[model samples]
Target: MKRQFKKHFSHNSELKCFFYRLHFHYDFYKKWGSTTPISLSFWVFTFHVRENICNLTLKGSVTVKIISVTRIIDDMGRIVLPSNARKALNLEEDYLIMRIDNKKHHIKFSSSGRGKEVPIDESGRIPISPDYMNKLGWETGTEIGLFMQGEEGVLQGNAPSCVICGSNQALLLVKKTHVCEDCIHTGTEASAEKWSAVLNDLFQEYKQYCEAAVTFTNTEDVHKARTKGRRLRTLIQFIGIKKEHPLYKCLKEAHDILGKVREDDVFIDAFDKEAENNQYSELYRKFIQKAEEEREEHRNELKQKLPHIIDDEFSARWKTFSQDELKDCVYKLDIETALQKYEKEFSERVIKYQKIKDKKSDKGLDSLHSVRKKAKKLRYIYNFLDLVQSIDYSRKSRQYKKIQKDYGDIIDLRDWINETGSLGEDIQDDHDDVKKVRKQLNQRLKRLVKQVEL
Candidate 1:
């Protein structure tokens, strides 16, 4: 049997006999999205009104006391506000503002009448939209001609010099849009003349990922790895290479390395938990021993061929850029020079597998597999070209779409695998479904790799 209740929730103000209780917490505002239309306007008014009253009474001897109130919700979830608070706060029945910070886990109430109206240009930069600016008959290069003060104090809405760069000129109306010349000029030019910006941005992003990855390794930190992944994607996006390009193909390999490391870490953790819980801990121990041994075997193979890997590809990149050319960038200048030296070591993993792609030696093949896995860290850096150059948040972009398709499900499965490892082998029966899901995920991975390969 299915039952559904149709509850009505409208942006309505009803005349109430009691005052609603409100709480304020700063931490909520410090964090993520608490800025819904219902939330934003209410908070803005609540903050301003509180500040307004405080300022207005500051000069005088009068100390205004705003009463704290609470509404008690019964077991049935019905809230009754205290009658006294309603009368004290001048409660009138009109559509008023209610602020909710679900993130901070608090709620507040305010009357819309508390907000003072300030003049704004229709375009909305002066807190008015561009259409409104046109409606208001604002001309291009409008002078600093407006000012306003609420009970709190003065809040002049006048446009100032550009914020990004120090230019005394105000934003002008150009092509029915208000934008400063500095802001316009600061944007990346699409022309061939400014292509160096793209190249510089690519190298800088690559440096950032390398630094972050190194930091992750040193700290054994999950957060640093996540940051490294994000920056690596950004760098890959900036390079904007086709999937078929040799550089991008190499990047795909780098992606697999991080993916494998993350996957293996999760699997091992789960294996460790099973060992701890089961009476037959030997099985768990054996599983971990096998996994570790496999990892070591892979590592050894990479180490053996690493010298050649470094020498082959990295030397080419180094020679393409002079010592001075590499040294001048901010990312290059900030990170230790050893990161550059280490690239030679890591590239060996990437290049060695490519060299022996057809080798019949099973040991060589298996060893090469792990090296290829580690190579993904490099691809993660390389793939950022698409992210930084082409991805646009305002519109549907191909890079974002591909991420939703390629990485989204894999990340979920990876997290699940990590958590399952914590439960140990004693709970293996409980994780039959998880194991099935992982099998499905492996199939997905095969498809994703094939699509990129094609």
Candidate 2:
């Protein structure tokens, strides 16, 4: 039972209690299934089954008081979603996402809206949200391109009109996401502000989809993880954040996991064609040998990250557990207790550095970015602790998960590029490959920094 339980709720100590309770109920159900007590605890963290978009969807648009969305549930355990919210959001199901606005926070129900294609500018760049833009490294003056096909839909009246088409229907709003079906036929362009709001959300959405692919099965069926991993690597480079930033490590980890699988797959697929062509065998052999050496170097580097893994068990049993057990059992440790300590320390440090960052007047110093980056690490640690107590474990933590997936790709790419440089041979193809990879690394790094920052 413990082993099976671990498969689902392995990381967090708090969940152990819930698991036992659930198992107990299950046993009771077997003996007296109809008479089994239906209690609130049974639905504690479970999403309500009856919630759906129809219950919350708005007809067009409505101004809503954000504070109304942040109501806390009382002991009665009933929640009546406000009429405005219910109609505006069209929420029906129990899955909840908190949206923090300027005035207050709102509890939103998650719904699977049919995805729409985003319009791209003549340079083939997709319009992205500000948050997503920060995540994807598309700040001012970044070059881009767009390619779309088919007729999509008319843009909202308030949306920005197409640069060329001048049609109001062709426009898209600043914060909202839009997909352009006519982009392939007639390409458009956008200003930086128009697309920045959705960048983080878009990238996050894509990243989450990739992470989810690994949950149902051992392997990733979706190729987006690898593809987006490379893009994120490129963004990482563009940002030029320090290697120590938590975001850097997060992307590094994510890239490493997906990269290994990608590299292995790519290598195998290419192996057959290269092997069959005797005329090109020599060149292919060199490439394959270099790739293998690079993989080994990367594998060794990734192994070094495990030492930093926080042990939740130690913190939980600080008062009662045996010394040896306290030292050894991270999973068994009470993470909530330990996190309080970490948070207190982090708050003090942040306040101290923020004071320093405030002292510098005229322009924001580069060191401020470093200080901000450190604060981000604290945020990440806090988030991880929060997750340690739940079933979400790794699936929802994109920053850390991405790092675990993609670090190998960065290391391997670095080594491969280095080898090509050191050999001093006229391997133009090798150099091109290295350049391509470096570009990907930069993007990934940019992505890492963005997420690492608060």
Candidate 3:
């Protein structure tokens, strides 16, 4: 009845005032006067614009028209409320932002406007216009709500207040959200001490390997030493130790020389195995002989190089280093933030590979080699930061590792194609087999390349 009388004032577009118009029994409307209008008392509604009908309840419903309002700011910089709006809202001279409920979605507005409009610039000068603040009842020291719903934010309800003071400066986030610098987050001594122990252990292992690698007589023994040097180099990079620190360049050079022997040793063994199994063994036998000669030369060079790398620069400088440098090595960033930063670096390799692929240039195959190397480094970077064992990568790490292996798989497939393709006319019986194997390898390689998508 109240709404039936209120229908005349409903959907007033001129004043941008929308109403929930309802019609009821004639006797009810007769009792209540025109000024006291009965309207739908709905706090919230899900309006589907496509449907004209209002789905009010699961039961039978009344006609409830929802009209959209468009308000204009008057030239005097004031919103003039029409008679219906003033009546509906019970208007007074002053209102609080917390009292108004437009009821679309929730947005948090705090006193200091944290995660809202910043008032000052880098020079500590106020950037907002004073007149604009005055228009919104915002004085210099007065606490106000600035509700924003746009591109930069889609925050709902309320966020946690500042972790230290329980103030609503719940803006800055690190390991935990709402932990402001004025309170909870600090450059931790406990964290630094923990990482120091990890660094000390790594430094000691690297020193032992540098000492022991020279005495190694076999491939497997040397490989162990090489792996130690590599993990140490990677650890230094992971912790972002200063490059200008004297050991950086010298240690990297030493690792490179150690890696050279491993690759040659791998190929020599592959050739010898090929010689033993091939139907036409004479050709592969000659290949194995040549490769054997190269391996001998590599071994001779490594024997001299490993000792010089250890004695000259690495051990001497490393021994004199203070524990303070290692203690200062851990990143201040929380584990989650640090992982995200590292992952961004890891994803950049995919971006680089994608650029090469998209170009459809002849050099795509050659460029993939560098991407493969970077993939391997990124895949193992987490292993180097073993101190942060609490961070779990159980699910995502498999996919991360699979990508690395996929890149390496292409490398292996290409080699197989090349080897089988080079068997020449003298090896007649193996010619057909070689051709078939090459075709298979080439096709498999093509399929594998297609799978390497970012």
Off by over 4 Å in 2: 1-285, 290-334, 340-399, 402-412, 423-454
What lDDT does model 1 reach?
A: 0.36
lDDT value for candidate 2? 0.36
Report clash pairs, candidate 3.
2-38, 3-38
Better of 1 and 3 by TM-score: 3
The candidate that wins on TM-score is 3
Q: Where does the lowest 10-residue lDDT sum fall in candidate 3?
A: 43-52
TM-score per model over all chains? 0.29, 0.23, 0.50
lDDT, candidates in the order shown: 0.36, 0.36, 0.46
lDDT of 3 by residue, 1-454 (tens): 3453244334333111222321222342243324343222210000110011111111122221111122233333222323332233332323312211235343322222233343322222222334444444433344322212111221223334533344544233322223233332122333344455565677777666656655546666556667676666666666565667667776777777766666556655665676677664565565455555655676677778767766745665765443456434443223444567767766675577677743223366556766666555555566544333333444455555676676776776665455445433444565665565556657878887887665
Q: Return the lDDT, model 2, position 336.
A: 38
Write one digit per residue (lDDT tens) for candidate 1, span 13-129: 210100122232334333312542323223322322222222233334223322222222233322333333333335344222333334433333343434323322222121322
Deviation (Å) of 249 in candidate 2: 22
Backbone Cα, N, C clashes tallied per candidate: 38, 92, 2
Give the per-residue Cα lDDT of candidate 1 at 310: 28
Question: For residue 169, what is the lDDT in candidate 2?
Answer: 37
Candidate 3, TM-score vs. the true structure?
Answer: 0.50
